[model samples]
Target: MKKKILYWGILSAAVLVVIAASYATWNRLDPNYTCARCHEISTACAKWEQSVHADVTCTDCHGTALESFNSMSEKLNMVYKHFTTKKTFEDIHLTEKQSLALANRCAECHQAEQASWMSGAHSTTYKDIFMDVEHNKMERPYWDCFRCHGMFYDGDIDDLMAMEGGPEDWHIKDASQMDKPAITCLACHQVHHEQPRGMNYKDMDETSRGALAQKAKYPSTALYMRADKRHMPADKLLKEQIFAGDSLVAEIKDANTLLCMQCHAPGTNHQLGSEDDKTTIGDFKDMSCITCHDPHSNQLKTSHRNVHKKLFSTLSK
Candidate 1:
């Protein structure tokens, strides 16, 4: 009786392992054909087939099955919904945490930029910003914080924390997001910026793609406006005037500068040097934000005041 039970158990275990392996293999081999049955997926797949990333596999960027634990949760959730409801994922947009998990994936192509951004202030993780004793004590956590930090975060500040009063009372609700940076590539860049490509688009080498990118006229740089629930293009963004007391300091025209001011905007009183505003005054009037604050790594120029003062002196000549 014991021998019979042991043999059956071993056989069952082997069968389960074989089944799991088969399922994983089938998922990775050719999911596009199955996915293409859906209209939106089909349209996206068709465009991707012609894009520069045609050679890239669907699962490479968007993780599915057992590829990544971070992505598996969401993927499995969506799959469960599809199986149970016979429904499609209507909202394809990923939340802030999910998107950040894919940030390193972007490094496969943009290594240099990724390294720079990782070293910058923008790389600050959720724990560093939200659970801060100093910051939270001063202002208290609020929805407004998401405007700049966790722009793509699906929930409000309260959803992330259980705050009673001080830092000691604060406990982050979702510990998984503690290590994830609130901002990511999607915070600034819009993928799929182009469609209907030139001939042999898939055959174009990296150098060719790099050359095209330099001259690319596409409006890809964007900012997430919580109200819009989407990243608004730089051109479409309204250019606001920065004021200093009674005088107007600067009116944003350049797309890059426009995006910067969207977050580093003037205070409620419409005054520069307030809130997060770093609007340069006096001799630096004509200069753009990117002139010093490199987007990849927003490292301030040496002794910011001295650097700009010298720059101003040079400009005068």
Candidate 2:
């Protein structure tokens, strides 16, 4: 009995020591250091070290998952990969839960902007797009819809919906995601963007600058490319000639228009005014989409929202 007790005690001590060491290491390990094992993360960390958000703690924006001891898939994934794979990895994608959690944190710093975004059409939830009765009946839901509506959604439409229920059934697999917005702050803006900060247009009086408050966003505008699982900066989007049959509709030369067109793509042949492309025509041809549409909300500017527009319309009346 004494011998057996001694052996059990020895085993227990070893286990305790291992647990203590692991907990300590986890607390002490810098996220940047652990992520350095992957080349892509290392490269991004190098940029972040010098970027404007350098002072901000990674966990603050990225969410507690980075430092969590919880049984989240990410923690398990990192550990499993460490043992099995070679040091380098090409892709390090965030799971939907982790991504959503990270996006929720942006509101902490950008309260007003976040509020405006929540009120915008771009902030549509999964239920708003996927489970719609009229639209689903008109067109069967498919993977392609994720390109615009749920760009940040980690899976295809089939994954989110119960296909077993047939074309008529639109049963969502996870009801919890019903309230979560498809397009998040991370959808349009890359936090680690290295560009100089946008002007503080909010502080400027409406008359001081020929613009309304919060009209200008920092140059962080980017589109999340589903194919690459990376954000392609707006300016880098290829300039293509839009056509209405043989008629040249428009040649996209600027980044702003190009950004919108990437997702609000033209028809298969790049035809204008087709496949959700609401290209303003006639008198509105010269006006930019942002001229009438509020950039964040993607809703039309209120009648009184723009002073110049209101004045011009009043004069015309």
Candidate 3:
């Protein structure tokens, strides 16, 4: 009986050792090479290798290992499916939940930008935007509403609210989504794209540094238009027509303001200051939307002191 007990104890210890070793191996294989093992994602892996975030691990931005219990199970399931099924992998896209998870990862590197985004109107929650009694009562909710309000949401506007038109009974379909942000950091920025290489601004001449800062391209700056379910590059957004009365006053062709115009401009009518638009006129006619409004924080930088101070402080830093 003593010999039998000793043998079982040794067997259990060996099982535990095997389990530990397997877990370690699983973790070790989470790097980019393991992801590239699947040919479908090899292109993405290659792009990531060339990106500014090349140093960042594949799992850091993509997986929710610590947050979700099903993350490991999901990966295992994918592997199983890949082996057993004949279906070829077309593309891998981030779900709303996965995209939301990236907010924390982004905050890890860009705390100041994250803080500014969180504090702004752009960070408004689904409940704040959709379930507002005053706003809903005034105007009817439609499918186009999600174009700006809940851009990251995978489902249609009908899936969110009950009624369409005036004085209708309304309630959120998913109570859990009430507090979740409709527009997240990924709504405006593309993580996979490369950025301008960091220059020694301090060592460079003031003119050279200023020129570099002005000309440096923000390749990652994009507007995630829910209507098409694709990211429109900030520089390539469609030019919007601004109207004063009957005549077209200006075509907002500025690349910098293009992303902002996606939501801030007038609706289909394309009239300035219509449908929650704050398009400026008079002395501010030539200025871009970003002239007064801080893009991330949405704070008014109208005053010369405030504008120049922020500019000089950024340059000095």
Model 2 agreement with the true structure over 73-171: per-residue lDDT tens digits: 666767787678665434666566766777778777666667778788888898888888778878888888877777767777878887565455776
Q: Write the per-residue lDDT of candidate 1 for residues 1-317, one digit (tens) a residue.
A: 99999999999999999988886776667546566666445656765675555666776777666766756677678767656654433345666656766676777777777888989988888898888888877878888888888888888877888887667679779889788787788777654433345623346675654344333244436777766666676666887777757778677666766777787776887776667666666667756665666566777665464654554355346
What are the per-residue Cα lDDT tens digits for candidate 3 across 1-317? 99999999999999999986875576567456477777767766776666657767776676634446778776677778777866433345567877787887888876766788888888899888888888888876778887877777878777887764444457688889889988888788777655443443334564654353234255446777675566666777777777756778767666656677777767667766567555555455546655566667887754733543443344335
lDDT, candidate 3, equals 0.68
TM-score of each: 0.70, 0.72, 0.76
TM-score ranking from best candidate downward: 3, 2, 1
> Best candidate per TM-score, number?
3
- Residue-level lDDT for 236 in candidate 2: 76
Error of 1 at 295 (Å): 1.2
What is candidate 2's CA lDDT for residue 83?
74
Q: Name the weakest run of 10 consecutive residues (lDDT summed) in model 2.
A: 208-217
- Which candidate, 1 or 2, has the higher TM-score? 2
* Comparison by lDDT, 2 against 3, better one: 3
